[model samples]
Target chain A: EDQVTQSPEALRLQEGESSSLNCSYTVSGLRGLFWYRQDPGKGPEFLFTLYSAGEEKEKERLKATLTKKESFLHITAPKPEDSATYLCAVQPPGGTSGSRLTFGEGTQLTVNP
Target chain B: AAGVIQSPRHLIKEKRETATLKCYPIPRHDTVYWYQQGPGQDPQFLISFYEKMQSDKGSIPDRFSAQQFSDYHSELNMSSLELGDSALYFCASSLPNQPQHFGDGTRLSIL
Candidate 1:
């Protein structure tokens, strides 16, 4: 079975503080890795998709990097609005269960202003 | 720029009752996926459809069934609803090999 595990289940940071969240995974064959941010009572918003090792994508204050076994979401200078649950999901090569995302437990990040 | 849309943002049902959740995918997207999230839990995949055809299955219960229509809209029919069925149900849409965009989700509560 495809599995994803995120580290540091909960994190608290001061405004403008920088940190990184880790997501480790094991899959039969990786098709894609996705990053999402979800607020309380809201659906996940798309962040990034990493398809291969050594690949990286960046948004305003977020940068996502991928490797063979894990992915990292680095926050450059977070604000209170940046606080949310970060989720990592993996997609396997197309099959009966492929195209369906298997998500990690997620990391709850809280940034204090 | 349109995102996926889910109807009946919130629902209330009783045990043994039946409920239907609807999803309208974004334009030009031919794939749709359903996921259920319990309190304090990550979203779990339920099912998916591509071009109006069943494409993938996950941990969905036997009482739940879903289908995509010719217009790319989808519905999830859940029967014999139980308290355990109460959760946030999300619908996502995407093109092949692209990132899936999610709807705000339908909050289902069973009493």
Candidate 2:
């Protein structure tokens, strides 16, 4: 079974604090690793996709890095607006149908002003 | 820069009632996926379609069925609603081998 595990289920950070969320996964053939941010009562917003080890992507205050068995979502100098649940998901290689993502229990982040 | 669209942003139903949720994928995208998120839980994959065909399924109950239309829009039909079925239903669209774009979800409340 493909599985994704995210650590530090909840985090409270002072504004401008930096921290990294962890996502570890086990899959038969890794196809893609995805990161998303979801606010309360809202659908998840796509953040980044990592395909191979050593790959990295960045947005304004967020950076994501991928490794062979895990991924990291690094929040740099986060602001209150950046507070949201961060989700991690993985797409495995082939199945009878189209690719379906396996998601982790998200890490809830609160950036306190 | 059009995004996926979902209908009936909020719905309230009683047990044993039936409900239908709809999704319109972004133009030029051929794939659509349905997911369910319970209160305080991560989104769970329910099903997917590609080219109007059922492509993948996961954790979906037998009372729930979904399909994609020729226009690349999709519907999720759920029957015999239960309190456990109350959730936020999300629809996502994407091209083959591309990242998916999601719509603001439909919040279903079953009493």
Candidate 3:
């Protein structure tokens, strides 16, 4: 069975603090790994897509990197506005790999001022 | 300049009633997906439709079904709703093999 697990289910940080969230997966094949940010009462927003190991993508204060069995979303000097639930999902399928995204439980990030 | 759109931002229905949620994918995007998110959890893939065909289904129950229209819009139908059915349902759109965009989601409450 393919499964994705996220660490530190909930996190709290002070303004300007940097942290990294982890997502580990057990799958037959990894087509892609995705990162999303979801605010309360809204849908999960697309953040990054990592396809292979050592690959990295960045947006504003957030960065995502992938390895063979895990992915990490790093927040640098995060502000209160950056506080939201960070989700990690992986595309695991032999065919199509079209739009099916298997997601983790998400890391709830709260940046306190 | 449009994103995925969903209808009935909030809905409430009694148990055993049928509920239908709608989604409009962005123009020219051929793939759309439906996901269910429980409070304090990640979004779970409910179904994915591509090219008017059902590509995949997650661990949803038999009472849940979905359809993809010719214009790439889609609908999720739930028959005989139960208390467990209450959650936020989201619609997502993306080009084949590209990153997906999400809608605001519809919160469904089953009483």
**Which digits, one per residue and each the tens of the lDDT, describe model 2 over residues B1-111?**
899999999999999999999999989999999999988888899999988888888999999999998888999999999999999999999998788888999999998
Model 2 ranges with Cα > 4 A deviation: A95-97
Better of 1 and 3 by lDDT: 1
Leading candidate by TM-score = 1
Per-residue lDDT tens digits of candidate 2, residues A57-104?
999999999999999999999999999999999998765335888889
- Alpha carbon lDDT of residue A47, candidate 2? 99
**TM-scores for all predictions:** 0.98, 0.97, 0.96
Best by DockQ: 3
- TM-score between candidate 2 and the true structure: 0.97
Docking class of 1: medium
Return whichever of 1 and 2 wins on DockQ: 2
Task: Give me the TM-scores of chain B across the candidates.
Answer: 0.99, 0.98, 0.97
- In DockQ, how does model 2 score against the reference complex? 0.65
Please write out the lDDT profile of model 3 over residues A1-113, one tens digit for every residue: 67999988999999999999999999888888999998999888889989999999999999999999899999999999998988898887446624578889989999999
Ranking by lDDT: 1, 2, 3
Clashing pairs in 3: none
When sorted by TM-score, best at the front, the candidate numbers are 1, 2, 3
- Descending-DockQ candidate ranking: 3, 2, 1
